[model samples]
Target: MKAIEVRFAKEIDKSFVVFRETGKYFPCPWHYHPEYEFVLVTKSHGRRMVGDHIGYFDEGDLVLMGPNLPHVWVNDESFINGGAAYDADAIVIHFQENFLGKEFINIPEMETLKKILDLSRRGLVIQGSAREKIGKLMVKMMTMNGLQRLAALMSIFDLLSQSQELELLASPGYTPRQEDQLKGPTDRINEYIMLNFHREISLQEIAGVSNMAVTTFCNFFKNQYRCTFIEYLNQVRIGLACKLLANEQNKIVQVAYEVGFNNLGNFNRQFKKIKNMTPREYRKRLDTQLEEDSIFFNEAYIVNE
Candidate 1:
């Protein structure tokens, strides 16, 4: 596949397009479009690549990408190999950055909206309460038309602009490049890392995989990802460790080895560095979040009854 992709949306009278995609798997290759996109993964778990950032995404993943930012959600190997039981689904919305009109920012009411659009250049992940509210709004847009649909989209934009839970996905230094210059070595490097993250990987091995000398590979990776190869590898491991910690059955020491850390002390240091908390503390927070969610849901159920 080419590095950058051009997506041409069909002509519609509406200001933006909303699409609900369901299939055995997500088939889109690495690509980018001119339109700014709002994507919600309703079901599926996989590695989601946005520009130079690589991380796993689960159900309810929501992101906004600015014009020309490259991205794709590649489902786990089981799903792609056709042995997965459940199907994958997503709700995607596409629109130009100037969808509200070229002079829309001139209005005093749109200052926050303009800022949000600018931040979308690095891509934003909506989370917490805002994610739940905006997700329902995205679904609601699918059934409405004309003014109603436009109003729904605007509401989403407004909430996103004010959201405190938004997280930027790509690094600050990430910049879009020509298709030919973007896909070759970086794509291969990312795939190699994802596939081998659970095992011990050395600089020489990865550099050989990229067909470059170790020193040359280090420079190339730092230039592209804004971080050294070891740092990126640890980030990936820590991310997976986070997911593993969420499961009550996995102990911290077990998770450390599972994600390729040779020693628990090293794992603890790296985990704390990235998450600002120890693994045990992170798990405790997750437990608290789950308890709060359970209580909230129970109360809502009783109120509805």
Candidate 2:
């Protein structure tokens, strides 16, 4: 998608931002900003897009994204169209990579923090007990001020740096260009592809968007993105396909065409190549997992009762 550039109004005397965002639903568009973000979905169920990865998110969804990584959280259909009962809420933290100091991360004591920050370029989803602990700290940080708030943030970072339960979003091949380089030809070309990937996009048409010859555009795209134009396009389509498949009502073949694949065979081939499984297998696994979660939740509730 063509992400809007978002600029936050700096709060005077504050080196970082930590606040609760509540609404009928998250109103942010697909966007990027020049700050690393820590987000914990406290009350919501939705689809989260990070870089080129698409997946479902629910309450307790926690992710850390590096500066300039494009992302957005879209509420589920019920939250968007349902009446007043549904409310989306999250604890959000935004900080510059150098918030502590330019040389802070270079010190021996900060090695793990530095490593986690580097890994955040692909975005990291905190999982298991680490997520629970960090979520509590973030909630506590809401009421804190001054040194305490900063201390809480460092604690969260400490937890993240040591946690093995971290899942990386975005593909290994996906790279986010720096914000200063936005609107350049390659960026424009990428935006165009993201916006039109659901429909037919011709090589000549995309090259025209870049004002380059077809051959030149192809070479330029490969050099800049480290992937062929078609490969990147399929990556986007497959990402969307993963989201659509979350709704069990959507048929597999229907999803293929919906994601812009011209034929079922080609969709299957690409899906397997990117996802390492057939669509059918992917859906089945998702269903099984959901069932297990539901069972676990119910059992815990009964025991508590």
- Top candidate, metric TM-score: 1
Pairs that clash in candidate 1: none
Clashes of each: 0, 0
Candidate 2 weakest lDDT stretch, 10 residues: 296-305
1-305, model 1: which lDDT tens digit per residue?
34556666666676778888889899887788888898899888888878766667899989989888888888887788878889999999999867778887668887766777777777888888889999999888888877898888878878876676666777778876554344778868977886678789999999999999999999999999999999999999998798789889999999999888999999999999999999999999999898786666434322211
Question: Once superposed on the true structure, which residue ranges of model 1 sit more than 4 Å away at CA?
Answer: 177-186, 200-208, 211-232, 235-251, 254-258, 262-266, 269-305
What is the alpha-carbon lDDT of model 2 when measured against the actual structure? Answer: 0.83
What lDDT would candidate 1 get against the real structure? Answer: 0.82
